[model samples]
Target: MKIGIIGATGNAGSAIYKVAQQRGLDVTAIVRNAAKAREVLGADANVIEKNAFALTAGDLTKFDYVVNAFATPTAYQHIDLAAKLVRELRENKTTKIIFIIGASSLLKPDGTKLLDSLLQDENAANWIATPIEQAKELTFLKLIDNVEWLAVSPQANFVPGPAAEYQLGVDHLLFNAAGHSIVSTGTMAEALVDQIENPTVPVRTRFTVGDK
Candidate 1:
């Protein structure tokens, strides 16, 4: 399958790029700068570096699937960018879009979200804003329907590490006895590839990575 990972040079994007290649899929990575894209991601994978804001309907049509794991520098602006992507898909009739949302959107057992928990302290508000930005983009996507969208939440404590054992859950969360939710980038990448081939259509729900 031919796939395009929008924001394919970032940490999460780079992880996906490597996994896709190992799986033998035809992949194209769209990044913001060509030179950096080649340097950071290497020159083996197909890559196109262009300002995301400058992407058009034609740009979106170049792939069979597009996973938007990119995040804007700010939250409010991120929503506008996400809207553009949704609009771009509609205009081009491109049907599949997988958005890399934040873990803040997921609900804790107490009914509060990860974002709400983090916002309780002054020292953490600024830190939490990053995830809140993801929430904003997801809120805007709620109004879109032209594409099949999948939103994924990394474990509550997303960190850099090798792929570990995990589970998958939809619309809620998966937590271990230690009350921590975590999954390696490698595990998340595996679940994503599953969705790419046998996409859960009309499944605009959010999924999480946990101990499988």
Candidate 2:
């Protein structure tokens, strides 16, 4: 399958791009700096250098799947990019879009959204905007009914590590046998590619993954 990854230089996106290549899939890195992409992905990597928001409909529709791993310090762009992509692909279901949203949108065991608890942290103000906007991104995505989209959230503590056994859950925060809510980038990438290859989750909904 043909796949394109935006923000392919980031931790999660790089992991996804590398995993896709290891599987021998036709993968392209949609990045801003072609040289950096080559440096990170490889000299042989196929790349399309352009700002993600500047990407045209014609550019995106060429791939069977596009993973939006674009992260920004400007948190509001999280929702903005989602809206732009949805607008570009409205009523066209051929190319599926997958969003790697923040874990703040997941649900706790008490049925409350995880963002609430995150907000209660004393130091949350230091880096709360991204999670807030990501929750908004998911909320906005849920309102759209026409686009073929899937959202995936990592566990409460997402770290840079290698792939491992993982368990998936729908809308709820999942914990492993040791009661830790965490997932490595590689594990998330593995789950995401599995979904792209064999889509089991219904479109327009969201799912989450945690280390097992």
Best by lDDT: 2
For residues 127-205, could you state the per-residue lDDT of candidate 1 as single tens digits? 7667778877667777776666667878777765666666777656677666778766777777787778776534566
Q: Give the top-scoring candidate (TM-score).
A: 2
TM-score of 1: 0.91
Residue-level lDDT for 174 in candidate 2: 93
Q: Candidate 2, clashing residue pairs?
A: none
Q: Predicted candidate 1: what Cα RMSD to the true structure?
A: 1.9
Candidate 2 structure quality by residue, lDDT tens digits, 1-212: 99999999999999999999999999999999999999999999999999999988899999999999989659999999999999998998899999999899999999999999989999999999999999999999999999899999999999999999999999899998899899999999999999998888889999998999
